[model samples]
Target: MTFTLATWNINSVRLREGLVAKLLGEEAPDVLCLQECKSPVEKIPLEQFAALGYRHIVARGQKGYNGVAILSKTPLEDVDGRDFAGLNHARHVAARLENGVVIHNCYVPAGGDIPDREANVKFGQKLDYLSEMRDHFRAQRPHKAILVGDLNIAPREDDVWNHKALLKIVSHTPVEVAALAETQEAGRWVDITRQDIPSGNLYSWWSYRSPDWDAADKGRRLDHIWATPDISGAAHSSRVLRAARGWEQPSDHAPVFATFDL
Candidate 1:
């Protein structure tokens, strides 16, 4: 089977459910994974999505806070969500397709403005969450799996507009970057985005604070898509729907896409 997948930080799925519908109408990926839904599972506006042929959904949500969901055009079985770091946040969810491929969607905590773990409790939690991810993947090696989400870390120099300038910032900081790397290594996951794009100032997220985000173009590749090496070769057409960021009242982060033939 061949299918296209997209991952996005919708920020607040309910607030921007229309944007989600618009994307589903236009881009029409087979599967869409969303983070920061900020609504209880029962409260997610699924009727609208269901009318558009996205009849299957698996989600973990928290009222007015972190949440994640996966909507698929085809039938899929829920693989449940994990509370990484025991944070009790709806930060992760997984599903399995009939073809046997597993999809893991995650929303890593955004470490606060202060990067120092000692100075910020959120920063410490971020590190601990990543450590648990690394340990989990190390113990249970993944195969024929694709992991996607707003990981909230930009690991590569080219992932941000100004690497040096943002190094001290939360997302591009070396400590967070290293932790993400370790997790990826533990899973033996191939970064499907970088593998296809290879190089360039690739970005999926722009700060909402920027008055003219498009003109300034100070963005970071905080979202990601990764697949296990065994089936990584089947993945292609990696891209970021940059124009989505320009939509009216849009999410700061745009959608990232990849296709796989398995």
Candidate 2:
């Protein structure tokens, strides 16, 4: 069967509840993986989503930050939310579908304003978190996995609107990019979004600070969907719903999606 999966960093599921429903109605992806929910699991407005036919949900959430959820039309099993490098943040969650496909959703820490780890504790923690991810995936070696989320790092020059200008920026810094690359290599994950749309300037996030976001187009491709080598060929029809960024009080990041014939 062919299934469409999407990943988005909603910023706060509670705040943008309307946009969530709007996205479901418009895009209609079979599985929706969300990050940065910023709400407790109990406050996720489950009934509202259920009314729209998303009956299955697996989530990890805290009070006001760092949450992830996987909402699917298909039943999910073996849901897991584990700490990365003992960070104790609600940043990772995973579930297995009946079709034997595992979906791993993550919201990697956004290293603060400063790019230097020595000057920033958050930056150091971000690097450590990625290191732990690399170690864990290298040891476990997940197969037929679809990993998606706002990884918070733009690894390529094409991922940012102005590579030279954003080189020292938090999300596009060399350290952050190198750490993300290490984790990608350890898991042998193919960046599905980039794989299909390779030769262009692509971005899934535009800062709210921009007055004319669409015209200025100063955006970053912080959100991503990656598939393990075992099912890489099945990955197809990837897209970034840019219009979502223009929605009412929308999240800083947009949805990234891919279709897989698994």
lDDT of 2 by residue, 107-159 (tens): 99998999878999999888999999999999999898989998999999999
lDDT for 32 in candidate 2 is 95
* Colliding pairs, model 2: none
Residues 221-253, model 1: lDDT tens digits? 999999999999999999999999999999999
TM-score of each: 0.99, 0.98
* Model 2 residue 11 distance off true place after TM-score fit, in angstroms: 0.8
Tell me the lDDT of candidate 2. Answer: 0.92
The C-alpha stretches of model 1 lying farther than 4 A from their native spots are none
Per-structure clash totals for the candidates: 0, 0
Q: State candidate 2's TM-score.
A: 0.98
Which residue pairs clash within candidate 1? none
